[model samples]
Target chain A: MFGLMTGQKIDRIPVSPFAMGYAAKVCGFSIGDFYANAKVNFRSQLMAADMHGYDSSPMYGYASIGAWEFGGKIGFPYEVGHGAPYVIEHPVETPEDVDRLEIPDPSRAGSNPISMEVAKQCNALGLPAVFQVGGFITFAGNIMEPARMLLWMIRKPELVHKVISKVLAFQKLTADWYIDTFGPEKCMVFSGGATESNKLISAKQFETFTLPNEIAINKYVLDKGIHSVLMHPCADQNANIPHYRKIREECGWRGRYVWNFGPETPLEKQIEMFGAHDIIGGNVDPPSFQTKSFDEVIMLCKDNIERGMKNPSGYILMPGCELPPLTPPINVHAMMTAARKFGSFE
Target chain B: MNEEILNGLADAVIAGDVEKAEKCAKDSISADMDAYTSIMEGCAKGMNVVSKKYECGETYVPEILCSAEAMNAAMDILKPHLKADATAVPKKIVLGVTKGDVHEIGKNLVKLMLEAAGFKVIDLGKDVPTEKFVAAVKEEDADICALSALMTTSMIFMPDVIREVKRVKPSIVTMVGGGPLSAATAETYGADGYAKDASVAVKVAKDLVRSV
Candidate 1:
């Protein structure tokens, strides 16, 4: 993965499959156990990485961990098949809630201790840990009503900024802690799930509200000597891709990076837009991963690999986002097989 | 002068200025302009411009949201003046995110666009149960039911919700959308229509209503 990101030649295409939920199934653990217990999370991640020959292990836990730490109500399911937990109550309801908000200490907050422990375990196992943290906009959405937050961006710009500032502070602290403990070289910061799709927010709004904080968090990791900043924006974020170039320029980011495009973004367009970057990760339709046949999945993977290789940038075979928790294992195997057969650099 | 006021009302909505929208609405009423005329020619017309800009990638969520707010403010002033017959019949829509999914931005945007297109929308909010969708449809006599889900986990609930709605009233058109859904999935789940985004949703809802 590092070799691909640094413009060095590698024998084959790097494949770091973002299989969080599928990993749990591989280790005979439930999604609930996988998320709540650090040991189980680490074991499943390692087992899945080894089984699939994944290049890196993703350290993604419950999406609402940070929000839960800061006073949001998160509900975890007990049974394995019941699916992942969700936020039942948001911490912020009104503009005044922004003023009342305080950053949670990363060392002791809700699930951060457990998550950090999992990262430590991964590093101890010699597995490269990609510490995935939620972006400011997504974390804010988790802690507050998402639609109200977007409206607040227009009606109460100051209040929105106030909330975002607090979230960014917490994000920076979390990133710093990971860098301090795991060391910058072994760690990659996946600051993602901004959820600010072009369909949802305009380029102007993205530039004004979302871009600054993205730059801040990415810059924080870069300054600490972390070269790989993996950005995962879900859904159709084709419009937001150009803004990332601006982010690269403003932050003076010279390090390796991965840009994961959503399904709506065609591979040709992704190559046209970001082919000059270090690593281009995706464009696979997540729904198809759940519904398509194994042969179909392999065909899709081959098509994407062929088109993605057309650009000089190193390509990683990954889902557009996290694989659907119920995605069939055969399809994932087919993806790796396709990558190896067609993605040989030699 | 009346035409100028109506144009100003549309311009206010396009600019997303709530106060300006309200003022122009009041001026239209005082000038004996038909409230429906003001809404169609002024507020909705302005929203049309916003929608165009949105489609052309010239505008985004925040601007569309502010414009929705501006249109609502104008509607508040003009609604009281509209004759009972003129306002009595607009197609009604029941909208919500599926159970276990708290994502509401997509649902809310669809609601806003549907309203701007002159539909009466009843938003059931996020994490709504399948039964609630059935209840809303039966009670509101809705012409369409729109379901949204952002997670793959939550998307499984969509087929159940669609089934419950069909059981209650097979006549009511059902539409589904969100981050993880595609038109094929929507068809597989038995939805009448699917839209990738809010702008397309409005047109889909209208077409669904007409087809029904």
Candidate 2:
């Protein structure tokens, strides 16, 4: 993974399936247990990494720790095994509510302590850990209603900024704590889900509301010498890739980030647009991976890999987003096999 | 003069200005304009423009939501003035995010679009069970059942909801959408129709109602 990120020749392409709940199920734990128990989260991730023969283990299973601590009601449904906990209640309703919000301590907040322990455990195993944080826009959306957040962006820009500032501060503190405790080398991968994709927010709104905070969070990790900052944007964001050039021009982002294109964004277009960057991953059809045959999975992986390799930057074999829980394991193996056979460097 | 009022109302909705929309709606009512014409031409026209911009990628969710809010504000003013028989006979829609899915934004957008297109929508909100869909269809005498699921896990429940709805009210057209769904998946789940987004959802719902 490091070799691929650095534009160095590798023995073969690094294929890491972004499996969360699916991984937990493989380790024989219910989704409810996985979210509540640090041991279960860690074991599941490790075992799933081993089973999938992936390049690395993700440090966090659930991404709602911060929101949960901020008083959002998180629910672990019994039937949705290993699926992400849904926010049953939002904490902030009005602009004034943003002022009342408090940032929870990373060492003591809801699920944060458990997730931190998981990171420590992953580090002790000499595994490179990918610590996931919800992006400020997503965190803000989680704490408040998404529509209300967007309206506040227009009606009360200052309140939105005030809340997002707190979110960013909390994120920085959490990142620093992880870097301090787990050691930056042992926890080399840092990712944030900017799921508030351009598909939902206009490019102008993204520039006004999302870009500054995104830059701050990414810069914080980069300053700590973490080179790989995966920006996971959900849904079709094909129209918004040009906005990244604005980030490069304004924020001085020099191609250290990897862009995870959502499934709807065509791979050929992604390769044509973003393959010149340091690292660009994804564009696999997640629905097909979950339902299609192993041969189809192999064909999908091979096609993506072949297209992704056309750029000199780097490519990682993976799904457009996290693999759905119950995605066929044989299909995952097919992805790996395809990477091994066709992704070899010249 | 009523045409001017209707035009102003549509412009307010297109601009997503709630206060202006309300003011124009009041002006049309005071002018004794037909309430149906005010709603269809003024509010729905604005939403139609917004939907077109959304389809072309010139606008997005937040903007469409703002426009929806403006349309709703105007509708609140014009609804009472609508003739009893005219308002009573519109097609009904039952909309919700399916059970196990808490994502409401997408579902809410579809509701707004459907309402703007002149349908009466009964929203069941998020995490709606299969039984609730069937109940809503039977209770409301809905012509369309629109379900949304953003997660793969939640989408698995769509077929169950569709099956139950079909069993109870075979005449009700079932449609499914969200980030994870494709037309093929919607078909595989036995959905009568599939829409890729809210803009397309309005057209699909209209077509389904017309077919029925």
Error of 1 at B101 (Å): 1.3
Under CAPRI classification, how is model 2 graded? Answer: medium
Error of 2 at A236 (Å): 2.0
Score residue B3 of candidate 2 by CA lDDT.
85
lDDT of 1 at A255: 80
Model 1 residue A34 lDDT score: 77
TM-score of 2: 0.94
Itemize residue pairs with steric clashes in candidate 1. none
**Candidate 2, A1-346: lDDT as tens digits:** 7667656668888887878777877777887777778888888877888777877565664445446767678787456522687676778887678889998786776667777777778777766556666366677877776778877777677888888888878777888887888666555544444346776787777777777877676667767866556666666666666755455445455546676768777766766665666566766888788777999899999999888877567788878888887787888889889988999875
Q: What is the C-alpha RMSD of each candidate to the true structure, in Å?
A: 2.9, 2.3
TM-score of chain A of each: 0.93, 0.90
* lDDT to native, each model: 0.80, 0.77
Among all windows of 10 consecutive residues in model 1 chain A, the one with the lowest summed lDDT is A76-85
Report the C-alpha lDDT of model 1 over A148-222, residue by residue, as the tens digit: 778788888888788888888887788788888888988877767645777777667777877888877777778
Top candidate (TM-score): 2
